[model samples]
Target: MAQVANLFDIIHLNKKLADKHIAAEVHLRDACGRQTLWFELKDVEEDTLSRAQDVAISYFAGKGKPIEFDIAKGINFWIKQF
Candidate 1:
């Protein structure tokens, strides 16, 4: 059940980030604290991406799940979450 919840959480976060035009790279960690999966974002804005990360964390945390997201530097982010 927990694994499924985590999986859905990852999926939901990914979709939300994508919709906001923020390129992201998702790395799912295993129960043993090892990375198990990786997702890379396509065309996106730097500012939107950064803000998206913050919003995502908050959105997920509100759902009783907190996620860690890192945005690479030198990227151009223009869009805001609103």
Candidate 2:
């Protein structure tokens, strides 16, 4: 909700400052095998979030679903709606 929106705002304003904020919230969105990695925050010229990020975060959070993304399992994600 506002949490992710505020993050986008900070990122748009200052990427350097956003790094600190993301680090702080790492614990909330992730554990050892974190999956809520929202957007690509590296080496990109564009300073905007992708459509995938916006829709997925909103849909998953709204439906109380968790997306489990695993690189080892053939690099895919599943929205656990069960």
Q: CA shift at 56, candidate 1, in angstroms?
A: 2.2
Per-residue accuracy of model 1 over 11-63 as CA lDDT, tens digit each: 87677776765677554656442333444545554465456557565655677
Per-model CA lDDT versus the true structure: 0.51, 0.38
Candidate 1 is scored at a TM of 0.51
Q: Estimate candidate 1's alpha-carbon lDDT, on a 0 to 1 scale.
A: 0.51
**Model 2 stretches astray by more than 4 angstroms:** 1-50, 72-75, 80-82
Q: Tell me which residue pairs clash in candidate 1.
A: 45-77, 46-76, 46-77, 47-77
Tens-digit lDDT string for candidate 2 (32-56): 4333343434433343333333444
Best by TM-score: 1
Clashing pairs in 2: none
